[model samples]
Target: MTAIDQSAVETLFTNARTHNVWKDKSVSEQTLRELYHLMHFGPTSMNCQPLRVLFLNSQAAKERLKPALMPGNQEKTMKAPVVAVLGYDTEFHEHLPRMFAHNKDAKSLFEGKTDFINTTAFRNSSIQGGYFILAARSLGLDTGPMSGFNNAAVDEEFFPDGKVKSNFLCSLGYGDHSSLFPRQARFEFDEVCRIL
Candidate 1:
């Protein structure tokens, strides 16, 4: 009904930055759970909530992910209190029977349609990933979302069964502003949008 205040807008959008460096503080498991609770409410087509997240917070897990990272992403990823491997489950439609109870045929709709299933899984999981970043920001955490890694390697390391695929990696924590580059310009609304 009503718009959120300017400070809330700033917290979630206008002033949010892609963090590279992080403060020494740690992100508690409770906070991480809360972040998921907040983002899970974001909508998806047919209620096909396909996104799966793996939070790499320990030294051993970070080590496992190191070889898959691009050189630029390694340091920041290792240093951040949490590195989230946001993935999409190819078998997401299997859950539709439970998630979309009113529509009994929802699961069957995607059962044998590989192309359609892939498209929906990727699209909706990506949308949820955006929600994840905003949810983290709303909770006073900063995020550095990067896609500069070997997807296959990440999948082999984290999702060995091949049912889930990595979409992107996001490093999260209290950001160190000193490491931020100057904000870049964005296209004006009129230039990027159409009202016809």
Candidate 2:
């Protein structure tokens, strides 16, 4: 098969930025569901799909999240159309046997090993979080991925369960062009990449 067009792929990668502001227009729940459906197809280690997304769009939910955010991020997160809480379930491996489609007793591996389970869960779920950013972009949405938050506070307010922990937060919306700064520069391929 012929390789995908380099320039076009480069455009998508280069042009995507962390949008901080958005117009007043709303994002439909259906659109969010579609995004999840598409991104779930992305691969994960051992088919252990641990990422759990919590979309906070309601006034009450956003209010609850306010205290957890850094002061700098609170305004943007609250103003954005939707704030996605990317989290991972420590119990993800419990369903791995079914997810793997035939690997019986997969749950046994993580049954009592809390440390190992947390490691795998966070690693794979972080991959899913990256998938979410690309998936949202593909659906004509702009994203602002942020980690400037109190994860422990967020988990207490939103997740509540110790098994599910927050990874990062991202604002999603139809971006406001008026709020964007000039695109920043990137290192040259030769400067950043080395061939053996």
Each candidate structure's TM-score, on Cα atoms with residue i matched to residue i, is 0.98, 0.91
lDDT of each: 0.95, 0.89
Candidate 2: clashing pairs of residues: none
Candidate 1 local lDDT, 1-196, one digit each (tens): 8999999999999999999989999999999999999999999999999999999999899999999999988887899889999999999999998999999989999989999998999999999999999999999999999999999999999999999999999999999998899999999999889998
Model 2 Cα shift for residue 60 (angstroms): 1.7
> Distance (Å) between predicted and true CA of 64, model 2?
0.6
TM-score of predicted structure 2: 0.91
By TM-score, the best candidate is 1
lDDT by residue (1-196, candidate 2, tens digit) is 6875866465357777889988998889999999899889989988999999999988788889999989998888899899999999989987887898677877887888989999999999999998899889888888999999999999999888687999999899999978899988879999989999
TM-score of 1: 0.98
Off by over 4 Å in 2: 1-11, 190-192
